[model samples]
Target: MNQNKRFCLALDLKDDPALIKKYKEYHWSGQAWPEITDSIKSAGISDMQIYCTGNRLFMIMEVDETFDPKKKAEMDVNNPKVQEWERLMDQFQIPLPWAEDGQKWVPMDKIFQLA
Candidate 1:
């Protein structure tokens, strides 16, 4: 598993039911998951899955060791479609109670790995 170089990211959704409904609608409207999965695959990611439970979204992405996070960030920032997607989705996202301002999605740190 270590050799595979997969990373997991977890994020929480707003507790409000209306916000959750908006979030799901926005996500589904853009057909985002499939497109994002395709983009990651084309960028050399081997496997990916996103799951939601109790207002939490967890993403597991299997990426090549050479994958460049900086490049990915740049692409995301510069893409108009991505920008629009974020803008639409941002309406429903609420920062965690302890999150810093302007931070809605927080990345979980990796603490353990399986053999």
Candidate 2:
């Protein structure tokens, strides 16, 4: 069995209960669009999960050696289905005030791990 590398990221949803509920609906209950999951797998992501508290979301992603953020980003740039999904998701997502311009899902640093 191969052990995949893990990465964490975070983003925030608009501070509205209704929109946040819809956001959770799309993500929870296995309702995510097929194209979105396909794109993620094609990008070398072996597994992904998202957790939310209040309006903030945390994501854990596990990927194989072939995973390259730059490459995945370039691929997403040209994928119409991914683009459409992103546009729809944008309605419920809000950039963290400290996020870089137009950036979503900012990478998080691991502070400590008990080994």
| Candidate 2 per-residue lDDT over residues 1-115, each given as its tens digit | 8869999999999999999999999998569999899999999999999999999999999999999999999999999999999999999999988899989999999999999
Model 1: per-residue Cα lDDT at residue 60: 82
Best by lDDT: 2
lDDT of 1 by residue, 1-115 (tens): 5656767766677788888866766555445665555566666678766677778877787888667766776777777766776777776666666667766556668877697
> Which residue pairs show backbone clashes in model 2?
none
Task: Point out where model 1 deviates above 4 Å.
Answer: 1-3, 25-30, 33-35, 97-104, 110-115
Which candidate leads the pack in TM-score? Answer: 2
Give the range of the ten consecutive residues with the poorest summed lDDT in model 2: 21-30
Task: List pairs with backbone clashes in candidate 1.
Answer: none
